[model samples]
Target: MRELPEIRFLTSGDVTGAEKSTAETAVRSALAGAQGTVTAIRVTLSVVADPALPRPALAQAIVDVDGRRLRAQAAAPALPEAIELLRDRLSVRAAYLRAS
Candidate 1:
């Protein structure tokens, strides 16, 4: 069996443990179908605060596959949504890579 990719999460601002776990789970599910195509994935989550209200969370995902880098970013009201969006983008890229 092929080895799954290593996932690293770098978080900033206010991030709860549950949020982190959700992001990791989303990434894992996203990559489940492309196990052999990806070697490592790094996700960065940034929470920005505004004087009036809190801004949406920003998530950036970088996937390393065969020495090539695939990146995607998303901003959402919730952390999990942002991470899931990034994962979805990566999944699309992974599919293309597999086909090529």
Candidate 2:
């Protein structure tokens, strides 16, 4: 079986330790099944917060697989949720890449 691609993350903004961990885990899980297909994975996360809204967090993710790049943006009430949204979006793109 081919080895899974190395995943590198570039993060910025108000990301906390726990949130970073969660995002890493989510990215790993999201790409776990892509084993022999993916050559490399890079995910960039940018988190934005609004003082007026204490609950929701806005985040954007730019995912690179092999030489292709895709972008996804999401807003959720928590960091994990926002990360999950990004992972979900990337997973779809990954699947499409594999199919083609």
Find the candidate with the highest TM-score and give its number: 1
Q: Stretches of candidate 1 above 4 Å error?
A: 35-37, 51-55
Error of 2 at 98 (Å): 2.1
Model 1, 12-71: lDDT tens digits are 988888888777777666666663567778988888775454546888878887787778
lDDT for model 2: 0.66
TM match of model 1 to true structure? 0.81
Question: For residues 1-100, could you state the per-residue lDDT of candidate 2 as single tens digits?
Answer: 3355566767777777777777767777666555244555565555656667664565555555565765666677777778888788767766776787
**Model 1, residue 29: displacement in angstroms?**
1.4
| Model 2 regions more than 4 Å off | 1-6, 35-40, 53-56
Which residue pairs collide in model 2, if any?
A: none
**Considering only N, C-alpha and C atoms within 3 Å, which residue pairs clash in candidate 1?**
none
Clashes of each: 0, 0
